[model samples]
Target: MSCQRGQYVTAAVVTAGAISGAYYAYRWYQENATKIPEQWTQVGTLKDIYAYPVKSCGPVIMNKAELSILGLKDGWLRDRFLMVVDEKNNFVTARAYPEMLLVHPSVKSSVLTLKHADMEPVHVNLAEVVTNQCAKTARVWGVEVPVFDCGHETSEWISRILDKSSNNFRLVYYASHGARTLRAGTSKIYRFTKNDTGALPDEVPFNLVNQASVDDLNTRLKETQVTPRNFRPNFVMKGGKAYDEDNWKFVKIGDNVFEIIKPCFRCILTTIDPETGVRNVNADPLETLKTYRQSTEPAARRSAGSSPRMGVQMSLRSAPGGLVKLDDPIYVA
Candidate 1:
């Protein structure tokens, strides 16, 4: 009986020690998870900054901009804060109507101006849209988002430019106070918190492209050369080896810090020319990327299928309101 008691006590002590060790290990990881490493590698330099005030439309290039949780911002211009929707409130993009890519959106003072080569420039009073327009819900990528209609005048303007016969389209601005719930499949892959959903962006708030990578891809093209604009990245970096961004978990530019969330999977959109609004006949770059850039992990392969990995999607890790500027050194940890 005495021998049995000794064995029982020894087993109990062993189990207790294991539990204590696990507790301390978890505590250590929790404390260190968010801490930036002391040593970081200088990966590249910020070459350009882009803010797409309207989704699938032209970008507003800036030398310096404030980083917000939603995305890059100036006084009245925020990234992907305005989107075009059909009469049914379904989101529209350049994918269906390639001419949408040619619409240039710019903001000055309290007005938003939209210019297209084929049509006259139209202006919308942004302040009036916010103060007077009624809030309504619009569907985008299977998510419902709160938005304000910019009235029939702007709607008619956009509709005439895209499709002259049908007055079935409308211009909508994001209601700044509301958030859209991410689709279950997207949330599974991105692991975004409630606060991470930003306006009408396709996914995350920030997208970064390495210029070296685009150059490398151009080398593989037989008849076509692609540029960073094809990828629609918010931040463009240079001076790094091609595809070095694949390994970066976190990056810092100026005083702004961003956590790399996932590899941006390329799609048919990359095949479209941002300048001409025409798709490549051969789909050379995307086809070329398929040969080499497919994700190796089985789970990632299942999630992304045949899409090739290009830039990295990111979220602001440091507090918002930090400024990122042209030529800022990009440090990766």
Candidate 2:
């Protein structure tokens, strides 16, 4: 607490002070430099760069996106964005008609637009897109799912959009369980298309990364080579190596905090190229992850939080919470 900048300080005094400072530095390194076990990297953060508005549609780049309890941004344009519902039984889009890709869709305000090569912006009100005056529970991704209908006009409008010289084209409503706990079977049971299962809309998990992990992964792959987008992550970190967040029980970023309860299980979704909507069941980034990142496979045939988790998609606490900007520091309290 007292000034000792002058040569008046004795040689012994200076030596002692230097030793104390070195000791403190060593202690600081010990506290901050240690990496999480099975994770040889430091902590890192990943900012959501692009928001895919309509599921499997297009990516909407955001200046900022809110972090919610479920990782689903409250007012996010990508939150519960677009869904391809089966015209036959009120199901969502999937592999039934792979040509559904030919059907492009967009949304603005309370209206959603569905169009294809020859189709026009078929406007349907979000509030009245379909009407069944009833509820239906269907199996999706091997799980039971319940959804409600929009009403009459919306249904008629959707039918009109896909009905042009079309006999098997129709529209339905998809009730999304945004950012729920990781339930592989549940997700795989809810059907969107014939072979396609439902998604937990806002359900991507938060896989913590550290600086050391980034350095190591980069040492092997280099650059932002293996990207978080590959995992469709809702959060990311660049300051460390991959898989650096293995042992974290909880983490907070900016003003949002999330519980790191379990390892997120991986699925074939990561194999699908979000850009081209192409599917390659093997020889993917997952191959690299499998070499290092696959979590302990579950005991039973299926379980929640038992799959290979890559990121944490927290449940939305507030509708479109607030903005989680780029480079925001994530703190593990």
Each candidate: RMSD = 15.1, 18.9
**Top model number, lDDT:** 1
lDDT, candidates in the order shown: 0.82, 0.44
Candidate 1's displacement at residue 88, Å, is 1.2
After superposing candidate 1, which stretches have Cα over 4 Å from the reference?
1-33, 187-189
Clash pairs for candidate 1:
none
Global CA lDDT computed for model 1: 0.82
- What is the lDDT, from 0 to 100, of the residue 262 in candidate 2? 44
lDDT of 1 by residue, 126-219 (tens): 7667656667889889788878888888788889878894478999988743236776677365556565567798888899999999999988
| Model 1: number of backbone collisions | 0
- Taking all chains together, the TM-score of candidate 1 against the true structure is 0.88
